[model samples]
Target: MPDSDKLAIAAHLHVLLRRKTGRVTDTEWMAVNADYAAEVVRFARQRAQEDGVPELADWADRLDHAMHAVAPPAARRPLLDVATQAVRQRAVPAAPEPVPEAPRYVGGIR
Candidate 1:
Protein backbone atom coordinates (compact mmCIF):
# COMPACT_ATOMS: atom_id res chain seq x y z
CA MET A 1 0.00 0.00 0.00
CA PRO A 2 1.01 3.60 -0.50
CA ASP A 3 2.29 5.85 2.27
CA SER A 4 -0.69 8.17 1.87
CA ASP A 5 -3.09 5.25 2.35
CA LYS A 6 -1.19 4.19 5.45
CA LEU A 7 -1.35 7.73 6.84
CA ALA A 8 -5.10 7.86 6.21
CA ILE A 9 -5.66 4.58 8.06
CA ALA A 10 -3.46 5.71 10.92
CA ALA A 11 -5.45 8.91 11.22
CA HIS A 12 -8.72 7.02 11.30
CA LEU A 13 -7.44 4.57 13.92
CA HIS A 14 -6.18 7.49 15.99
CA VAL A 15 -9.64 9.04 16.04
CA LEU A 16 -11.28 5.73 16.94
CA LEU A 17 -8.85 5.18 19.80
CA ARG A 18 -9.44 8.64 21.16
CA ARG A 19 -13.20 8.34 20.98
CA LYS A 20 -13.41 4.84 22.47
CA THR A 21 -10.57 4.90 25.00
CA GLY A 22 -9.82 8.61 25.55
CA ARG A 23 -6.25 8.02 24.47
CA VAL A 24 -4.79 10.79 22.31
CA THR A 25 -2.21 9.80 19.71
CA ASP A 26 -0.19 11.51 16.97
CA THR A 27 -1.21 10.01 13.66
CA GLU A 28 1.82 11.29 11.77
CA TRP A 29 4.20 9.95 14.38
CA MET A 30 2.45 6.63 14.49
CA ALA A 31 2.83 6.25 10.73
CA VAL A 32 6.63 6.37 11.02
CA ASN A 33 7.21 4.94 14.48
CA ALA A 34 6.86 1.18 14.55
CA ASP A 35 7.14 0.93 18.33
CA TYR A 36 4.38 3.44 18.95
CA ALA A 37 2.22 1.77 16.31
CA ALA A 38 2.74 -1.61 17.97
CA GLU A 39 1.79 -0.20 21.36
CA VAL A 40 -1.39 1.29 19.94
CA VAL A 41 -2.23 -1.94 18.13
CA ARG A 42 -1.90 -3.95 21.35
CA PHE A 43 -4.00 -1.48 23.28
CA ALA A 44 -6.69 -1.55 20.64
CA ARG A 45 -6.75 -5.32 20.54
CA GLN A 46 -7.02 -5.52 24.32
CA ARG A 47 -9.81 -3.00 24.35
CA ALA A 48 -11.62 -4.83 21.60
CA GLN A 49 -11.51 -8.09 23.56
CA GLU A 50 -12.65 -6.44 26.79
CA ASP A 51 -15.45 -4.48 25.16
CA GLY A 52 -16.41 -7.29 22.77
CA VAL A 53 -16.27 -4.91 19.80
CA PRO A 54 -15.33 -6.89 16.76
CA GLU A 55 -15.11 -3.77 14.58
CA LEU A 56 -12.25 -2.46 16.62
CA ALA A 57 -10.51 -5.80 16.40
CA ASP A 58 -10.92 -5.76 12.63
CA TRP A 59 -9.36 -2.32 12.32
CA ALA A 60 -6.54 -3.39 14.59
CA ASP A 61 -5.87 -6.42 12.41
CA ARG A 62 -5.71 -4.22 9.29
CA LEU A 63 -3.29 -1.85 10.96
CA ASP A 64 -1.13 -4.72 12.13
CA HIS A 65 -0.84 -6.15 8.64
CA ALA A 66 -0.15 -2.77 7.06
CA MET A 67 2.58 -1.95 9.54
CA HIS A 68 4.28 -5.34 9.37
CA ALA A 69 4.09 -5.88 5.60
CA VAL A 70 7.24 -5.03 3.66
CA ALA A 71 6.90 -2.55 0.84
CA PRO A 72 8.39 -3.57 -2.49
CA PRO A 73 11.25 -1.56 -3.85
CA ALA A 74 10.48 0.98 -6.58
CA ALA A 75 11.48 0.04 -10.11
CA ARG A 76 14.40 1.95 -11.58
CA ARG A 77 15.39 2.52 -15.21
CA PRO A 78 18.06 4.50 -17.08
CA LEU A 79 17.32 8.23 -17.41
CA LEU A 80 17.47 8.04 -21.21
CA ASP A 81 15.07 5.14 -21.30
CA VAL A 82 12.61 6.96 -19.06
CA ALA A 83 12.82 10.10 -21.18
CA THR A 84 12.27 8.10 -24.39
CA GLN A 85 9.22 6.43 -22.90
CA ALA A 86 7.75 9.78 -21.85
CA VAL A 87 8.29 11.22 -25.32
CA ARG A 88 6.72 8.20 -26.96
CA GLN A 89 3.66 8.42 -24.72
CA ARG A 90 3.22 12.11 -25.55
CA ALA A 91 3.65 11.63 -29.28
CA VAL A 92 0.11 10.32 -29.81
CA PRO A 93 -1.90 12.34 -27.34
CA ALA A 94 -5.70 12.16 -27.81
CA ALA A 95 -7.66 15.28 -28.69
CA PRO A 96 -9.60 16.92 -25.87
CA GLU A 97 -13.39 16.45 -25.92
CA PRO A 98 -15.85 19.33 -25.61
CA VAL A 99 -17.43 19.92 -22.21
CA PRO A 100 -21.20 19.61 -21.84
CA GLU A 101 -23.22 22.73 -21.05
CA ALA A 102 -24.73 23.00 -17.59
CA PRO A 103 -28.52 23.38 -17.19
CA ARG A 104 -29.75 26.82 -16.10
CA TYR A 105 -32.54 27.29 -13.54
CA VAL A 106 -35.67 28.96 -14.90
CA GLY A 107 -37.47 30.32 -11.84
CA GLY A 108 -37.08 26.99 -10.03
CA ILE A 109 -38.87 25.08 -12.83
CA ARG A 110 -35.98 24.07 -15.03
Candidate 2:
Protein backbone atom coordinates (compact mmCIF):
# COMPACT_ATOMS: atom_id res chain seq x y z
CA MET A 1 0.00 0.00 0.00
CA PRO A 2 1.07 3.60 -0.49
CA ASP A 3 2.38 5.61 2.47
CA SER A 4 -0.73 7.78 2.56
CA ASP A 5 -3.08 4.81 2.52
CA LYS A 6 -1.19 3.14 5.36
CA LEU A 7 -1.20 6.31 7.44
CA ALA A 8 -4.92 6.76 6.85
CA ILE A 9 -5.62 3.18 7.84
CA ALA A 10 -3.57 3.53 10.99
CA ALA A 11 -5.33 6.73 11.97
CA HIS A 12 -8.72 5.22 11.31
CA LEU A 13 -7.85 2.20 13.45
CA HIS A 14 -6.79 4.38 16.36
CA VAL A 15 -9.92 6.52 16.10
CA LEU A 16 -12.19 3.50 16.02
CA LEU A 17 -10.36 1.85 18.91
CA ARG A 18 -10.69 4.97 21.01
CA ARG A 19 -14.35 5.35 20.16
CA LYS A 20 -15.36 1.73 20.74
CA THR A 21 -13.41 1.11 23.91
CA GLY A 22 -13.06 4.62 25.34
CA ARG A 23 -10.28 5.12 27.88
CA VAL A 24 -9.57 1.69 29.33
CA THR A 25 -8.29 1.11 32.84
CA ASP A 26 -4.67 0.06 32.96
CA THR A 27 -5.73 -3.50 33.79
CA GLU A 28 -8.20 -3.69 30.90
CA TRP A 29 -6.34 -1.87 28.16
CA MET A 30 -4.92 -4.83 26.26
CA ALA A 31 -7.94 -7.03 26.88
CA VAL A 32 -10.04 -4.41 25.08
CA ASN A 33 -7.63 -2.96 22.51
CA ALA A 34 -4.58 -5.09 21.84
CA ASP A 35 -5.79 -6.22 18.43
CA TYR A 36 -6.53 -2.66 17.37
CA ALA A 37 -3.19 -1.39 18.61
CA ALA A 38 -1.39 -4.14 16.72
CA GLU A 39 -3.29 -3.29 13.56
CA VAL A 40 -2.23 0.35 13.81
CA VAL A 41 1.38 -0.65 14.11
CA ARG A 42 1.10 -3.02 11.16
CA PHE A 43 -0.25 -0.32 8.89
CA ALA A 44 2.22 2.27 10.14
CA ARG A 45 5.08 -0.04 9.28
CA GLN A 46 3.68 -0.52 5.81
CA ARG A 47 3.42 3.25 5.45
CA ALA A 48 7.08 3.57 6.32
CA GLN A 49 8.13 1.14 3.61
CA GLU A 50 6.25 2.90 0.83
CA ASP A 51 8.38 5.60 -0.99
CA GLY A 52 9.37 8.60 1.22
CA VAL A 53 7.92 8.69 4.77
CA PRO A 54 10.56 7.58 7.23
CA GLU A 55 8.57 9.24 9.95
CA LEU A 56 5.88 6.62 9.57
CA ALA A 57 8.44 4.02 10.67
CA ASP A 58 9.17 6.16 13.69
CA TRP A 59 5.48 6.28 14.43
CA ALA A 60 5.31 2.51 14.25
CA ASP A 61 8.25 2.24 16.66
CA ARG A 62 6.56 4.58 19.08
CA LEU A 63 3.35 2.61 18.80
CA ASP A 64 5.18 -0.58 19.66
CA HIS A 65 6.75 1.12 22.63
CA ALA A 66 3.34 2.27 23.85
CA MET A 67 1.83 -1.18 23.43
CA HIS A 68 4.14 -2.48 26.15
CA ALA A 69 2.44 -0.24 28.69
CA VAL A 70 -0.92 -1.92 28.18
CA ALA A 71 -1.85 -4.98 30.19
CA PRO A 72 -1.84 -8.30 28.41
CA PRO A 73 -5.14 -9.78 27.38
CA ALA A 74 -6.69 -11.92 30.11
CA ALA A 75 -9.79 -14.01 30.56
CA ARG A 76 -12.66 -11.72 31.40
CA ARG A 77 -16.41 -12.21 31.65
CA PRO A 78 -18.41 -11.16 28.60
CA LEU A 79 -21.17 -8.55 28.84
CA LEU A 80 -23.80 -11.24 28.39
CA ASP A 81 -22.40 -13.13 31.35
CA VAL A 82 -22.63 -10.10 33.60
CA ALA A 83 -26.14 -9.22 32.42
CA THR A 84 -27.37 -12.77 32.93
CA GLN A 85 -25.96 -12.87 36.43
CA ALA A 86 -27.63 -9.60 37.33
CA VAL A 87 -30.99 -10.79 36.04
CA ARG A 88 -30.74 -14.04 37.99
CA GLN A 89 -29.89 -12.27 41.19
CA ARG A 90 -32.94 -10.05 41.08
CA ALA A 91 -35.48 -12.14 39.21
CA VAL A 92 -39.13 -11.87 40.22
CA PRO A 93 -41.63 -14.64 39.51
CA ALA A 94 -44.71 -13.80 37.51
CA ALA A 95 -47.96 -13.32 39.51
CA PRO A 96 -50.76 -15.84 39.02
CA GLU A 97 -54.18 -14.74 37.69
CA PRO A 98 -57.28 -15.01 39.97
CA VAL A 99 -60.20 -17.29 38.99
CA PRO A 100 -63.48 -15.59 37.95
CA GLU A 101 -66.50 -15.77 40.31
CA ALA A 102 -69.60 -17.81 39.26
CA PRO A 103 -72.72 -15.89 38.14
CA ARG A 104 -75.43 -15.25 40.87
CA TYR A 105 -79.00 -16.62 40.40
CA VAL A 106 -82.15 -14.42 40.96
CA GLY A 107 -85.15 -15.78 42.94
CA GLY A 108 -87.68 -14.27 40.46
CA ILE A 109 -86.11 -15.99 37.46
CA ARG A 110 -88.15 -19.09 36.20
Candidate 3:
Protein backbone atom coordinates (compact mmCIF):
# COMPACT_ATOMS: atom_id res chain seq x y z
CA MET A 1 0.00 0.00 0.00
CA PRO A 2 1.04 3.59 -0.51
CA ASP A 3 2.28 5.74 2.36
CA SER A 4 -0.74 8.00 2.10
CA ASP A 5 -3.01 4.98 2.38
CA LYS A 6 -1.12 3.82 5.44
CA LEU A 7 -1.47 7.21 7.04
CA ALA A 8 -5.17 7.26 6.21
CA ILE A 9 -5.61 3.86 7.88
CA ALA A 10 -3.88 5.12 10.98
CA ALA A 11 -6.05 8.21 11.02
CA HIS A 12 -9.18 6.12 10.55
CA LEU A 13 -8.18 3.82 13.42
CA HIS A 14 -7.62 6.81 15.66
CA VAL A 15 -11.02 8.24 14.81
CA LEU A 16 -12.79 4.94 15.44
CA LEU A 17 -11.09 4.41 18.80
CA ARG A 18 -11.81 7.96 19.89
CA ARG A 19 -15.47 7.54 19.00
CA LYS A 20 -15.78 4.17 20.71
CA THR A 21 -13.99 4.94 23.94
CA GLY A 22 -14.39 8.69 24.33
CA ARG A 23 -10.65 8.96 24.90
CA VAL A 24 -8.29 10.80 22.58
CA THR A 25 -4.74 11.20 23.86
CA ASP A 26 -4.62 7.87 25.64
CA THR A 27 -6.10 6.10 22.67
CA GLU A 28 -3.68 7.77 20.28
CA TRP A 29 -0.73 6.87 22.42
CA MET A 30 -1.88 3.27 22.62
CA ALA A 31 -2.41 3.11 18.89
CA VAL A 32 1.10 4.38 18.25
CA ASN A 33 3.01 2.20 20.66
CA ALA A 34 5.17 -0.39 18.91
CA ASP A 35 4.51 -2.97 21.58
CA TYR A 36 0.85 -3.09 20.60
CA ALA A 37 1.37 -2.96 16.85
CA ALA A 38 0.29 -6.53 16.22
CA GLU A 39 -2.77 -6.28 18.38
CA VAL A 40 -3.69 -2.98 16.81
CA VAL A 41 -3.25 -4.38 13.34
CA ARG A 42 -5.33 -7.42 14.20
CA PHE A 43 -8.17 -5.28 15.45
CA ALA A 44 -7.99 -2.92 12.49
CA ARG A 45 -7.82 -5.79 10.03
CA GLN A 46 -10.81 -7.43 11.62
CA ARG A 47 -12.76 -4.24 11.44
CA ALA A 48 -11.76 -3.76 7.84
CA GLN A 49 -12.72 -7.29 6.93
CA GLU A 50 -16.07 -6.83 8.60
CA ASP A 51 -16.61 -3.59 6.71
CA GLY A 52 -15.74 -5.32 3.41
CA VAL A 53 -12.57 -3.24 3.10
CA PRO A 54 -10.09 -6.11 2.94
CA GLU A 55 -7.54 -3.95 1.17
CA LEU A 56 -6.96 -2.19 4.44
CA ALA A 57 -5.73 -5.44 5.95
CA ASP A 58 -2.71 -5.60 3.63
CA TRP A 59 -0.62 -2.93 5.39
CA ALA A 60 -2.13 -2.81 8.82
CA ASP A 61 1.14 -3.41 10.62
CA ARG A 62 3.00 -0.79 8.64
CA LEU A 63 0.24 1.70 9.25
CA ASP A 64 0.40 1.09 13.00
CA HIS A 65 4.13 1.70 13.05
CA ALA A 66 3.76 4.83 10.98
CA MET A 67 1.07 6.05 13.31
CA HIS A 68 3.44 5.44 16.24
CA ALA A 69 6.06 7.58 14.55
CA VAL A 70 3.66 10.50 14.37
CA ALA A 71 3.27 12.83 17.31
CA PRO A 72 -0.25 13.36 18.50
CA PRO A 73 -1.52 16.93 18.59
CA ALA A 74 -0.23 18.85 21.58
CA ALA A 75 -2.58 19.38 24.47
CA ARG A 76 -1.06 22.45 26.00
CA ARG A 77 -4.25 24.40 25.68
CA PRO A 78 -7.67 23.51 27.01
CA LEU A 79 -9.84 21.22 24.88
CA LEU A 80 -12.44 23.93 24.53
CA ASP A 81 -9.85 26.39 23.19
CA VAL A 82 -8.49 23.82 20.76
CA ALA A 83 -11.97 22.97 19.54
CA THR A 84 -12.76 26.69 19.16
CA GLN A 85 -9.64 27.19 17.11
CA ALA A 86 -10.51 24.22 14.91
CA VAL A 87 -13.97 25.64 14.37
CA ARG A 88 -12.53 29.03 13.46
CA GLN A 89 -9.70 27.81 11.27
CA ARG A 90 -11.24 24.67 9.84
CA ALA A 91 -8.30 22.74 11.21
CA VAL A 92 -9.36 19.38 9.82
CA PRO A 93 -7.68 18.97 6.45
CA ALA A 94 -9.72 17.51 3.64
CA ALA A 95 -8.66 14.22 2.07
CA PRO A 96 -6.55 14.58 -1.03
CA GLU A 97 -8.34 14.38 -4.35
CA PRO A 98 -7.64 11.59 -6.83
CA VAL A 99 -5.35 12.50 -9.71
CA PRO A 100 -6.83 12.79 -13.17
CA GLU A 101 -5.59 10.77 -16.12
CA ALA A 102 -2.73 12.17 -18.16
CA PRO A 103 -3.25 13.17 -21.80
CA ARG A 104 -2.22 10.68 -24.47
CA TYR A 105 0.60 11.72 -26.81
CA VAL A 106 0.17 11.46 -30.57
CA GLY A 107 3.27 12.71 -32.39
CA GLY A 108 6.80 11.96 -31.25
CA ILE A 109 7.99 15.59 -31.31
CA ARG A 110 6.78 19.00 -32.49
lDDT (10s digit) by residue, model 3, range 10-106: 6666666455434342344444455555566677677667776555565565566665554445725688987898797886678999999965675
Model 2 lDDT tens row, 1-110:
23344444445445533444342222234223557657656765675576355665675565566555533456456899899999997797768899798657667574
Which portions of model 3 show Cα errors greater than 4 Å?
1-9, 16-27, 55-61, 65-110
| lDDT of every model, 2 decimals | 0.83, 0.55, 0.60
Estimate the TM-score for candidate 3.
Answer: 0.33
Off by over 4 Å in 2: 1-32, 70-110
Model number with the top TM-score: 1
lDDT per residue (tens digit) for residues 1-110 in model 1: 66776688788888888888898988888887789888888999999899886777788777778888775656556799999999999999799999999768767895
Q: Give Cα distance to truth, residue 31, candidate 3, Å.
A: 5.3
Alpha-carbon TM-score of each model against the true structure: 0.63, 0.34, 0.33
Candidate with best lDDT: 1
Worst 10 residues of 2 by lDDT: 23-32
lDDT, model 1: 0.83
What would you estimate as the lDDT of candidate 3? 0.60
Candidate 3: residue pairs that collide:
none
